[model samples]
Each structure stands twice: as structure tokens, then as C-alpha cells.
Target: MSFKGEHHPGVQTPTAESAGFRFNHTMLRVKDPETSLAFYTRVFGMVVLRRLDFEEMQFSLYFLARLGEGDAVPDETGERTVWTFSQTGLLELTHNWSTEDQPDFAYHDGNAEPQGFGHICFSVPDLEAAEAWFDENGVEFVKRSDQGKMKDVAFVKDVDGYWIEVVQADRMA
Candidate 1:
């Protein structure tokens, strides 16, 4: 996506930094998996991929991705649902259930306010389209700034109050 920082057009894209290592998956801790699942599914348009349920502990596990036909569903289990999809990239959603054998623990500490996790980011084919969406949704954003020339940083918060950073940097290249 086209990213314009407070200063100028952001550097290159993130993929350029890593040799081949792309972003993998991001996990969040939810008070209720069902409620959280709903947020990702209904709001963000993600589908469940894999999930485990522990009826004994009253907990469930869920995995979700952006919806796309190219994606494949995993083997089914009685415990929970399996969902997968793709946008420009991938979005994975997980729901974990706790049983007598396992107790619940927070996966991440949302301490940085929105800046902590920042936010789970996805790629967009059109930066202007993305900006328009943000504008229509009343999403707030920080303009980008340049430390030198090849590095830029800015912040935006997600619905959950976690910071999502918009970054653009060109390795010494």
C-alpha cells in the first residue's frame, strides 16, 4: 500500500527488509473466545481455521483467516471450528479452550494501550483505498516522520485499544 509519512512517502515496504521471513501470525488474549471470534469474523471479515475445545474447563480454541477460495480447511475436530481465508495476505484467528488439565493464562499483556500490540496489520493493494477506509471508519492515525530517509514510523490504535504501527523502511539498500 502507498504509505505517506508525516514527512514524505515512507521508505520501501516491510518485505524488503527480511530476506524471506514474512510476518507469520499474531495472537491476542480475549476474555470470551466467542465474543472475540465475533469481532474478528463480523467486523474484520476473518474466518475460523482451527480450534480446540476443553469442555471440562469451559474454554474453546479458534483459528480464523481472511476468507478466500484458495485457502483450504483443516481436518475437523469435534471440539471447535476450523476457518481459513486470504486477503492480500493472511489473517489467522485462534480460540483456545481450557480444560481441567489446563488453566487459562493471558497470551499477551495489552499494556502499551493501543501501542502495545499496536495492531494486527494486513496488506492492501491500494494505499489510497486503505486510507479511505480508515477515514470512513473514523480511524485516527499519526502522520509519518523520518529519522533519516529510509525509516519511518507512525501509530494507530485498534478497536481493542492496542497500538498498531505503520512502518516503512529500506534496509541499507
Candidate 2:
């Protein structure tokens, strides 16, 4: 298959929109993988697929699957892109090389001002289960009620101060 005179295996002829293109996981760098991994797995209901190490590179990458993205298989061999699929979406935790010269990176803080990048939003089918997970993991939130669009929506933050919005969309009333 070819696209624009280039060999594109999946896409024979790419248009403005392609079926192969879809919204996948979001990436976040964490200073402490242990803490961040736990927070995401426990609070937001993520699962770790595997952990790879680059000893010479001096960093580790943790692959986590989002909510119902469990057991997703990817059929690609890429250097930077760890391929995975999810019922909802995918997640990739990239641990960069840390050395004497490597400067530290910063993750987002829950929208205290809403000026920078806004929080990443997700959808939870069972609102009660989502609420319970938050409470159990000690996630703090500022609650509000807005039902004009969907069901009730809530906000919460992870351990590293990254904001997350979980939408509770039930059937129409």
C-alpha cells in the first residue's frame, strides 16, 4: 500500500481523517515512579502492563493500561511508541534518563488557576465505583454539579498534583 508516493502499510491512501488515527493515551513524567505508579493504579484505576529498563540509558519506562484497557495487544515494533489498545484509552508512563546532567521535569498541578494545560478528562461508567476509589486513595477534590450536558461530573487530583476530571455519564433520565 502507498500513500502520497510513500509506503504506508496501514493507510493505503490517507485522507483528512483516517480510521487508523484515534485518540490514544496521554503521557506524564514523574519524578518518583513508585509513588506516581501507585497513585494512578490505586486512585484512577490504571494497571501496569510491564516495566522496561535501559540500564545504559539510565531510565525506566512503565506501561499502564487505562480503566478497561486491560489485556490490549499491540502489533507494532517501534522505538519510542509503546503500542497498546484499551476499551476506553491507553496510557504510557515514560521515565526519562536521570543523570548528573539531566535536569528535572515538572508535571501539571490540578487547575488552581486553569491557565496552563487543563486537566486530562476521562469517563467512568460506574460513578459509585469511581467515587469509592477516590476516597480510598485519599484523592482530594472540589465538587460541583453540572448536568446540562451529561450526568454528574467530578474532579480530582493525583499524588503529584496533576489534575484529572472524571465524567459520570449515565443513561438519559
Candidate 3:
């Protein structure tokens, strides 16, 4: 199917003033939840805000975020679901049940030949410090902050081989 949209140089799409919008979350399929969860929590200090299991569907969704200090997650599922929707900067990891038994299972990281998806990014307060911590923690590095042509950015791979771009907030223009 062919899709087409034309953009006039100075034209802007209109939306109702009452409409509210926000970029909610991006989901990535992971082979192993334990390893993937551990990597995000341990390396980035993200908390598992909510987890929804679909036994019949044979898949699970885990939502994680780096909440503000002293922020608490709601105990009740309904309240938690509301809280989850209200917050921003969420990372959702979807795990398929069958992948657990297949030790050799792997997912297309989107960076290969048929590249459709790129990489997810995280902004750090101190790029050097984060890079140091990553090195100390033995995390795999795809492109170190100093090695590539883009000297200000760094890329690292999670357990599932998904590339995450790490950038410094202050250094960004």
C-alpha cells in the first residue's frame, strides 16, 4: 500500500485546544525478562513500575521507569494502571513464553540489513560518569562516547542486543 501526505512549507496541522497528548512508551521484545530487567534496573536505576501477565496469550508486559526520589508506586492494579498512564518516560519490555526454553532464541535488533527500527536513547546528567559506571559494571558497549564520529554520544547494547543511545543533557544542542 502506498501512503502519501504533502507538507506545505508554512502550513501547520490544527488540533482542538482541549486535546491532550504525550509520547507514552516504546515497547521492545526481549528474549529473557530476568536478564533484560536486571540490565535496566541495575545499570540505569529504573524500577519495575508495573507488570501485566497474559497467561493465555503466553506473553508478559513489564513497564519500568526511573521515578523521582520518594515517589511510590500504587499497590492496587487499577490505581497502578492509572499511575502508569499518567507518568512519562516509560520502557516496556515484552517477553514471549516460548523464548525461555529456547536458549538460542534471539530477536532482530532492528540494526541489521532490514533496518526499520533504530535505537532508543537515554539522557544522562554526566556522560563520562555513566560511561565509567557502564565499564565498571561490565556492560557491553556498541560505540563508546569517544570512539565514533559522533564524539558526544555513546551507544550500548542490552542483553537482547538492542542498542541504546546515551547522551549528555548539557552537551546536547
Please tell me which predicted candidate would have the highest lDDT against the true structure: 3
The C-alpha stretches of model 3 lying farther than 4 A from their native spots are: 1-11, 70-72
lDDT of 2 by residue, 1-173 (tens): 44357565675665777756777667666667877887878666677765778888778878777634355454344522444432236566766655223445555563555566667777788766777777766777755334334347776766566677777666323
Candidate 3, lDDT over the whole model = 0.91
Best by TM-score: 3
What TM-score does structure 1 among the candidates reach?
A: 0.47
Error of 1 at 52 (Å): 2.4
Clashes of each: 24, 0, 0
Model 2 / residue 145 / CA error / Å = 5.2
In order of appearance, the predictions have TM-scores of 0.47, 0.62, 0.89
User: What's the distance in Å from true for residue 137, model 1?
Assistant: 3.7
Order of quality (TM-score): 3, 2, 1
Clash pairs for candidate 3: none
Residue pairs with backbone atoms closer than 3 Å in model 2 (clashes) = none
- Deviation in angstroms for 78 in model 2? 10
